[model samples]
Target: MMERTALISVNDLNIDVALRQAALGDRVLDLTPKGFDLLLFLAMNRGLVFNRKQLLEKVWGYDYAGDTRTVDVHIRWLRKKIEADPGKPKRILTVRSVGYKLEG
Candidate 1:
């Protein structure tokens, strides 16, 4: 059976992420194809850390030839839109040397 996609809100951020519409709350988020894919992946698997390489492969649909730093760049953009304070992120967290995890 096909499941309906619903809005995903983490914490009390007052924001809703609808993967179908690629939106964040009432405001439309202008995310790149890769950026959106990354966010959706993290959101679906919230609280679970995935390393850069893993994210790249899963989201990019292959083992990317690019550097893992791409994940950091996209994370930075996502925070600017979703995080209360992008500088000190709460929703998307950096797990030291491991990877990032969505704090759902």
Candidate 2:
């Protein structure tokens, strides 16, 4: 008899917050608390665009008074972990002159 496994799997490539706790191939991602939260937020609202200011207010909790580089850094980090090629990503997509979107 073939044994059935209950383990959840998110494709053979990558897994983000929407993918949950599932096998995501060979890529292993270690996220900070803030990074995880940001991923969760984006994953939950896939296909929707969110500006850095909006993300800061919603994810970071409160309006940011400093440089918005924090958002850019986290986005880059997330892309590195989730995208097969961070240079040309499919999941976390950047909207020109706007913000970012999580592609489903």
Candidate 3:
């Protein structure tokens, strides 16, 4: 029997958590460690909005000493890789003062 792999799909984006890989159609995306973690978390949660603090703790761990703005930078990078138009993002939506959420 073939082993079934776990996958998170949001539109054209496909993430393989087990392999720690993400791809847009046939092209594999080059994601940083933090960037991949953030994407995996958001993709798993789907529509739930998570604040910077929450993201830092979840994606970067509670021991992280960096500013919450790190999340913003990662989010921006992720949008560029995933969204057809990073300027007008469709997958990762900003909740303004609240934070961000992945629209699956």
| Candidate 3 positional error at 80, Å | 0.8
Pairs in steric clash, model 2: none
- lDDT of each candidate versus the true structure: 0.78, 0.75, 0.94
lDDT (Cα, tens digit) per residue for candidate 1, span 61-84:
684798888888999998997888
Please, what's the RMSD in Å of model 1?
A: 3.3
Model 1 residue 78 distance off true place after TM-score fit, in angstroms: 0.8
> Each model's number of backbone clashes?
0, 0, 0
Error of 3 at 62 (Å): 0.8
lDDT of 2 by residue, 1-104 (tens): 98653332233534444434322476456777787778777766778999989989988888568677799999999888788899998878999989998887
- Identify the runs in model 3 with alpha carbons over 4 angstroms from their true place: none
Selected candidate, larger lDDT, 1 vs 2: 1
Better of 2 and 3 by lDDT: 3
Task: Tell me how candidate 2 scores on lDDT.
Answer: 0.75
Name the 10 consecutive residues with the lowest summed lDDT in model 2.
Answer: 5-14
TM-score sort, best first: 3, 1, 2
